[model samples]
Target chain A: MKQDPDKSRMNFPNRALKWLVILMVVFLVIEIPLLISHARHAYFKIDGWFAFYAILGFLACPALTFLARGLGVLVRRDESTFGNEDDKTLPEDLDEQLR
Target chain B: MNNFADFPPALILLLGALLVPFLKPSWRSVYVILLPLATLFYVLQLKTGTGSQFNLFTFTEEPLEFLRVDKLSKAFGIIFSLNAVAAFIYAFYYKKSTQHVAALFYIGGAIGTVFAGDLLTMYVFWESMAVSSTFVILARNTEQAKGAAFRYIMIHLVGGLLLLAGVILTIARQDGSIAFNGFDFETANHAGTWLILIGILVNCGAPPLSSWLPDSYPAASVTGGLILSAYTTKTAVYTLLRGYPGWEPLIWIGCAMAVYGVIYALMESDIRRILAYAIINQVGFMVCAAGVGTHDAISGATAAAFCHILYKSLLWMTTGVVLYRLGKSNLCDLGGLHRTMPVTTVFFIIGCLSMALPGTCGFTSKNIIIHAIEHEHLFWPWLLLEISAVGIFLAVAIRLPYFLFFGKDKGLTPQDAPSAMLGGMALLGFFCLFFGFAPGTLYDLLPHEIDYHPYSIAKVTIVLQWILATGITFIFLKKWLTPKPGISLDFDWFYRKGAVQFYRAADTTLNGANALAKRTFIDGFVKWTCNFFESGASRSTAWLMTPIWMLQGHNAEEIDSLQQSIFKRSKRGAFQIGITAFCAVILLGLLSIIFLLE
Candidate 1:
């Protein structure tokens, strides 16, 4: 069997990368509130900075999730990624010219 | 206002694109050529120096504004139309009519962009270009093209969405309607500005979000690759000049793209991809010029943009011609073609000069930008540009020809390029020479005064020395730079592999608990409801049916049977006891609910 890199198990280096992504997300989330505070100080002291921090906090989890996915060295097991592969749907007669 | 002014020529060409696909085979080629030509003449007519604005009702409540004909816009519109004609001529017999139609619409959308007087109109044309151009990539008819087109569309649509947000926010923060000539950035820090910046940067191939381009562009069909090279990013450079010039961050971003693209191009073996990365590097020069924002800087930026489209398209067209004739585009699979494909080789050499070879179109225009940076004393951008100059020689200028044509002969012979391809190349090659020799013509067209000359002895000497030193480096290290079989990963690894693992890990941690809890909770509730209904129905039926059975059996002879039934009641007492027990259990449940209510 060809050892597909996408499906291969993570070696130590791969594991380390996932951990790094997690840590970065954590660090970003923790500093976000403080960063918002600092930005307000530099400009005008505005209340919306708090809402901004909250919004970032809400987004951080998903961002980290996708970031980790982007860093992974495994192939997706799900078949849905290729869409409908069974039909071999060439573009009908119109499809001939497009192809 | 005249109807000529009301319908911009680009829009008319765009509307005409739909009909191109339906035309007869004989008419297709002529239609493709004439539409852009007529459209070009129409845009030339708009040169009377008039601007119009209109609001449109689609994504927003206000009518979308369209601005027409100005100096800054005319430069881009005229050249874009010219590139369309050249591309159509090159693609005449190569790609299908469908792709030709798509390319026309794509070019039209790009032309619409330069004439747009407002941000909203620019964005509409911006997205229209994105959607239309994507079909060019998808025309390759490979599984890879499907994924590539998807990613390509994803990035541009994201750019479009951000642009919409930026335009809206900027309008809300301002007191007057948009005038699209040049940006006045003091008022641009509105919500729309960030949206707009992100939108434009996405198209400009800025980092962290830049992988979609290299990931997809090389996968396009041969003729498709030539069409793919021109509009998208340059439109972004145009938009940036209109909306966000002088933002200091753009300087660093431009420098980053220049170096990053050069490094990646050095690692790629695919010729089209190398050319694609070269596009990023060349755009970097203009972007940095935009960052400087002086009259000289803007002129340099504008000139660099003009030269870039011609040279970049030339390079892609050269490669596309070679691939079309030879049937392969990867450098590893190509070699010794200079013997047979002399026309392509000659054109490729001329195209290389325009990419910053001394005394070519690039040297004339690029020196002004590099000099503008030096005159401004921006040390970092200047140093990076110098390093990138060396890197460009290794990555593209020398590397492209060396591996593709002069490499260890790969035992393949391809015929000479077709006349259409040759004609396209000859036009670009001629311009490369003409512009290099007489740069004043290009310089005079710029929006600012031309005070700088690129042919001065000292500057030419410096550039020549850099090229010499780099060529010497290449001669010594040529063995190390040879193409090898390997695929290096880029930032896209996060989405390709990283995202899957992240999802799997989350599923792994929760799957067992989620399944167990759900099964137990649902199954137990279902069993309890089934048993309660079964016992209650049995008890209720027995109580109602017993008396009815006795009455129905009570005929004259049934009287005797009824008396016997009365006598049998004592024996049936045990059966009644069982029925009574069931009824008591059901009544107790009802009484408990009643008691709680009370």
Candidate 2:
């Protein structure tokens, strides 16, 4: 069976994801030791630990995203929340006005 | 200073603006492109430590410096002019002369503010910026644009007033000296300094006022937004760097703005608004650096601001092209545009220059701030800033491009941006790479000499790991992360909805009260007076006439005719003249009193 070029192209995202994970693993292998061996000083001890920045980066995204999602429940409004009936692009009373 | 060197670069652009309206279209394009270049040349020629001074009315002791040439101002001056050239190139396809003029004045105002040596001079150019930039927003001429422009100007006017008050109070305290310089916390405790800081903070998009930026910038015209992205907040950062370095509170405030911008950006569906919020995020870094107040930190802030103007403007221009072609800026309405707008995607992805990605301008510039934080051992802020750095990549670098160009196809096939816009983007994109690889070119322009490295193995490795991790997290959460069509409220909610509702409520109540008052007091009084005159006069006349008629043994008709004849005979006589003169004297006396009070 021949593969469709479009179908192959569509698979790029999935393949790209797998490759990304592999790349991350390889980066961790190299980075973990470098972080441990690196001469670091800090105002706080925990920040100087190996993988501290890496862990922060990994956690910050989901934490901030979820927090923002929670905030959205409070702050989110309709698309036209700032606008009013007068701000409508199309007049609602067009028929009446025309008549 | 020689006359040529003393000639203000800002005036050159402003004077050139007056010529734009009268020129032929071809000449107008050439003129716009050349004006900024000419101003840049003049600015470059300005000698170090030399400035133009003006003594207003010969009463003040210190002459106001209209043109100040120093490492800091020159750095900002160069970038601002370069930004103008790129912005005008992108705007070449736009035909409206008024927009071009407004843009010119806005750029001129920014340059003026950069070069101003005194608070008074800064305030004048500050107001010019507020007024001209409002026109840039208003130039869009949409109803939404109109509303946003009004809000934008109102916020800036308040900021400008605060700044003016601060200037006056500071000068008063300083024996009438209006020099613009840095102040420590002790000096900052003064009402004037705090007011000045707040004023500058408002422009920095700090905290509550931060929403004004995301609210207004996205509402500008395609070209207008790009122009706006370059100058306003960056200029504020420059002012903060000039006047309030080492203020510790800005660190927390700036971090709040950073996180605040990211969270809102994540919640936003509109691509332009996302970019707007990202501006607040990026400027947050600069503000935090300024607050850190180290030599390295200030240099970092300057370099970051310089690079930020380019990359942020590039992002805006790319999104602007999308809005111009598709008539939509919402992420939900955009996807898989990379196939059609490959050039824009290529340029837009260059916004990673602002993401501190390796081999980009952001890496070299933003790292300096991080290095300063580490050097200063501000552990908590360092952690927060580092996290926000990742959030920047997630919000702008990864999510923005993925949804805008690579995600689910929206079945819309808009063509690439026009050649002029592409040309502008390409120029900025090249500089992003050029400055990334050769950061010394930027570092050489800094106000201080410092040694910094961005390409170390540990740094590069950590950055890569973080970015890769962020990417993985994004992929896992892709489905959940897709933007839905809605608005995420920000501090703008207070003014946009709360203030407007308050105004409406007040208007209704006041109008109703006015109507009630008119009915109860005014109408009643008028009715009573009319009735009293009509009935009382008639009754009194009848009573007198009846007695007169009975006493004189004459008819009422005869008495009435005799009265009418007497009134007609006295019409032009001394009695009428005397009464008119008396009334005129009283009216003149009242008018004099009113004029005297005024």
Candidate number achieving the greatest lDDT relative to the actual structure: 2
**Clashing pairs for predicted structure model 2, backbone only:** none
* Residue-level lDDT tens digits of model 2 in B496-530: 78998999999999999999999988899889987
B9-30 per-residue lDDT for model 1 (tens digits): 6776778888876788767877
Q: Pick the candidate with the highest DockQ.
A: 2
DockQ (C-alpha based) per candidate is 0.02, 0.26
lDDT of 2 at B368: 92
- Model 1 lDDT at residue B216: 77
Model 2 spans > 4 angstroms off:
A1-24, A32-43, A84-99, B1-5, B537-598
TM-score for each prediction?
0.76, 0.86
Deviation in Å, model 2, residue A69 alpha carbon: 0.9
